[model samples]
Target: MNDDRATSTRSETPEAILHGGDLHAVSGRYPDAPQPWIDLSTGINAVPYPVPEIPPSAWQRLPAKSEERILLTAAAARYRVASRDTIVAAPGTQALLQSLPRLRPRSTVAVLAPTYEEHALCWRRCGHQVHLVDDADALAHADIAVVVNPNNPTGRLLPRDVLVRLAAAQRRRDGLLIVDEAFVDLYPANASLAADLPPATIVLRSFGKVYGLAGVRLGFAISSADIATRLRGELGPWAVSGPALAVGTAALADDAWLAQTGARLARDGQRIEALLENAGCAVIGITPLFRLIASPIAAGIADRLACHGIHVRRFPAQPTWLRFGLPSHEGDWERLAQALGSSS
Candidate 1:
């Protein structure tokens, strides 16, 4: 999607951010709200990195392997990746998440919990022994371990040295450490395994969250040369479309945009913290793209916010927690503020 593209502003309409899962499914409960939802659902960037106009030819031909090379080169530089030999570009991290398990033999896999659900789901679907653990030591006896850095929902940062040590332990057991750094672009200072990766460690990066280009479906895996070759050989050729490759290459090359966007998101995150605090909710964890608020009335607030045509994320595991993404426009902020003010 374009940088300026946004989800539905009407909670009743239920955009991609909500789909069949949340607000729309409960719209009947909030029939009095206005149309055009002030959606803050998901952790996607409200102000996306600017995308360059695509040439018509990008859509006309099959993507050449040469185009994939350019995209990988740009990604390597942008990510400060250890080496080009370590990177494997895929359609999206979801695709990588699903396929990575099958690349190796089935064995016990431990995934950090209170994180993205896909890691465990994919591993289980692939017939691996799946264990959910809260700490890194949980991977000790497993053949594989999955972690989301600057963790989702909590904004928890596990130190790199700590993870490197864990990777060494996993390595000794003939296991691999997979780190998902999907939200790391906005917080590079927060412990990342991307640069100078340790032995037997693989890092996953998603292009959609920071760039606001989820529709383009671009993501990458940074791993050993052997693993990279296996993934490439497995996916075959033209795994990424020509237009996505063209757009992603241009986006990754724009260092100025990335820097500016990081600063802007930091500021917006602070604003969200204040907004939630003023709304009588405790802002527990926040990243550049979103904030997690704890409120006794969280579920009620979510339903009320939907009544005001604003959609924010609510976690089933943490019944008293709500997550709010950055609101790009002044009007969007005002609407959210008004909704929070009057909802109770």
Candidate 2:
């Protein structure tokens, strides 16, 4: 028998897996454009919190030694934690996450998959034994468990009680639990797990997504003082900047803006959801800025929308899935409906 004939007929692995929201790459392929494009790939707040009137001092002064620490303390109070007990400000959650595995070296870590790739990447880079699973049930026995609450890309959330239970179970095993609440500010009532964190639990929140300040690189981790101290040590001193310190504090201190923004996003998200579902697309989850849907010809749809000056996120291999952002202007939704209607 010939070796070739005895072997399998085909063998190959593709060079790339298509990710959503690569607009700059797409635009590179198609140069002719009639109008400015709308970007829905990132789940950033389109209606950002209005930056407060900052005095000249905010910009001129080298961040006061106490400013960021004060802001972290005040922000922690909003989450109902004692001052300095539950907060550690970093440039952004990404930096802190990259540093976390080192803090818990040798711990058996479990990450929720079909989620943010960064979480797993960071853990693996740190040399932790990492396992990725879809279900929260599989995390109970791990030495450390990490999840993105209202997970990115999917917008799916594990209920607060379930998270509480998972954290409690991890604590029982002398393990740690970490929740990435980057999108939870978009849904407040359903987001109490952070406020009721277990002793071994740590919750990370991003000011970027909610405040539309991604450029500023501000975020924080909430935990008990001991855990906070550990994370602080891991991230090191002056991890955040002065301008970020001022803005983050001002944003949290504004309750009026929080309520108004949350309400507006809820209404807008519902409208977007209904429009997408009506266009024969299945909406998996909803977020203030964007929502995921199943598109039979997702890549084509994204490309077509691009031709029409409308940019949306498409996961190419999974041609049946895409995500779209909500436009605050009522007219943009009408345009989206027409574009999707024509494509579908």
Candidate 3:
């Protein structure tokens, strides 16, 4: 770790800073802490959609090749896409992300700044001239553009029309566009631009967040059939496990669960947002499961909260801002509020 990077975490109170894994890491370090930790690091739903118990038959049998196809087909349908138009199935998005750059290393990639670190890391490691663009204006100049919808940490969702226009413009330059729609399932009202994106665009989604099946490790890339075919050829078969395929198919097929889970998260998120706002945190852009707040003393606040067994996430690049995720239960939030109040 860079000295500069390590310096960033020094004063942060675990409670006010909300980066993924920070809360979990802190709790792991101090297992005997009295109060339960509040993890608002990753934007995963607190009440993840319940997974139906799988049948013994599912475990006993080798997940047929068709099972994987069915999961992908269901995902395409859920996103209102054609089955053959894109490639589905990866051991989470990380597998594809790590291997993808090798396929298009010569493709000059421009990733949005303060976004997911992996976008830049993986591409750069593969010898691509990865440019990190912070401002929307800077993006207009990049040949190939990458964006994170409802960008992690900041919780900012780029306008759909704006993204579409950018993608279309990139196609004119024969440049590809990639959008990670990992959080889009949380906001269904805004359609993902991937469906209508130009032929060169690729959209990635993880079934982990919405379904709360991160352990299952299912993610897919939506692109033109040509790209999908090529990726499939490169990725080979059985990229997803039998259990993951079964669980994903089950989760996607259940519309009632999706609806109920969305509503529940929206309610819980609002309650948490109010509590944070009441504590003088400005939660301008919040999703159903997480909120991003800016505080001049965010680092100090985070460190204080950590002593009380509260953990949050913070980005070294953005010292004054923090991300907060909802706790697993309502009682967790009540305790979180008291911790924040006491620290203040």
User: Which TM-score value belongs to model 2?
Assistant: 0.88
lDDT of 2 by residue, 138-228 (tens): 9886899998988877888888888889988988899989999888875765575666677788889888887877878988888878878
lDDT of 1 by residue, 1-344 (tens): 22122111112221122221255655666677788766687788878766788888789989988888899999999888857778999998989998898898767788888787778777766666677898777767688988898788788878898889889998898889999998888665446777788999999999988998887899999999999999888777889998899889999999898889988887777777777888899988777788888998999899888988888887776899888888888888888888888321
Decide which is better by TM-score, 1 or 2: 1
lDDT of 3 by residue, 1-344 (tens): 34443334332313242337655568776677666566656776666667778778677876778888788878877776756347667888877787677666355667887787777766656556667788765665766688888787667788887787787778888777889888888576555865555566888988888887777788888888877887877777767777788888888888888888888888777777778888888785566667889888888877766766777777787888878877887567767878788321
Q: Which stretches of candidate 1 lie over 4 Å from their true place?
A: 1-31, 342-344
**Candidate with the greatest TM-score versus the true structure:** 1
Instruction: Tell me the deviation in Å of residue 190 in model 2.
Output: 5.4
Q: How would you order the candidates by lDDT, starting with the best?
A: 1, 2, 3
Q: Candidate 2: RMSD over Cα atoms?
A: 6.2
Cα-based lDDT for every prediction: 0.81, 0.75, 0.74
RMSD (CA, Å), each prediction? 8.2, 6.2, 5.8
Q: Score every model by TM-score.
A: 0.90, 0.88, 0.87
The number of clashing residue pairs in each candidate reads 3, 1, 11
